[model samples]
Target: MVVFNAPFDITLINAELRRHDLGSLEERLGAETAPVIDPLVLDHSLDRYRRGKRTLSAMTSVYGVTLQEDAHTAQVDVSMMLGVLQEMAVRYPRIAGVDDGALHQFQVEEHRKWADNFGSWLASKGRVDDISRAWPQE
Candidate 1:
């Protein structure tokens, strides 16, 4: 599934599914875990040179997504996300053709790289705390 923030949304969904005795999402996917396309990770990887925030709104603006109204609702947010993905695919065509497993693995590596860079930057700023590089949690 494609999501803006895979970790947060997947965690909440898995927790609720587990609470209802529906089994974990991974089990339902017939794999170790569900395949996910994380736009946040993709954006960071593709536009590492770009500046400013990476919020959904910020991304929509960067990708030239036109919002008819506020994007507080899930429907609006999802639509905007799809639009952003479309723009990304146009700019980075290989992303659109990657197989599910390969795409999932790519996101995993990208997330790790982003985390490591962020940790190092934090260290450069005098914060010497360890950063958890785990993706989508355990």
Candidate 2:
């Protein structure tokens, strides 16, 4: 599965499924979620020093993707996100070269590192925010 923010979307999906007594995505797949690509996570990890927002719209602009005017719609957003991923892979060969399993694991660790660093930065500013380290789930 390819998603802009896999953690948020997958967690929401699992929540809704649990509300209805349906199995979570991982359960339905009968294994740990693998081969899921999150463009937002990839872009954040790969371009760590890039300035400005990492919103889907911001990424589209960064990657030269033509975002449709009605981009908040699911179909349009997904298309734009895929375009961003393609451009990311082209610009960063490691993204394209890595296997899916490894890529997923990489994102997990990268998210953890990001969360820790961001949390520390927030604390330095005297903010008491809790950033989650969970990836592709929470």
- Residue 134 error, candidate 1, Å: 2.3
lDDT of 2 by residue, 2-104 (tens): 8778888899989998889988988888887777889988888999999999999989999999978998999999899989999999999977999888998
List runs of model 2 lying over 4 Å from the truth.
none
Q: In order, what lDDT does every prediction score?
A: 0.85, 0.89
Clashes per model (N, Cα, C within 3 A): 0, 0
User: Considering every candidate listed, which one attains the maximal TM-score?
Assistant: 2
**Per-residue lDDT of candidate 1, residues 1-138 (tens digit):** 888878778878888999999988887777766477888989999899799999888899898898648786898999999999899999899898988889889888898898899999999999984766766653
For all predicted structures, in order, the TM-scores are 0.84, 0.93
Please state the error at residue 71 of candidate 2 in Å.
0.6
Clashing residue pairs in candidate 1 are none
- Using alpha carbons, what is the TM-score of model 2? 0.93
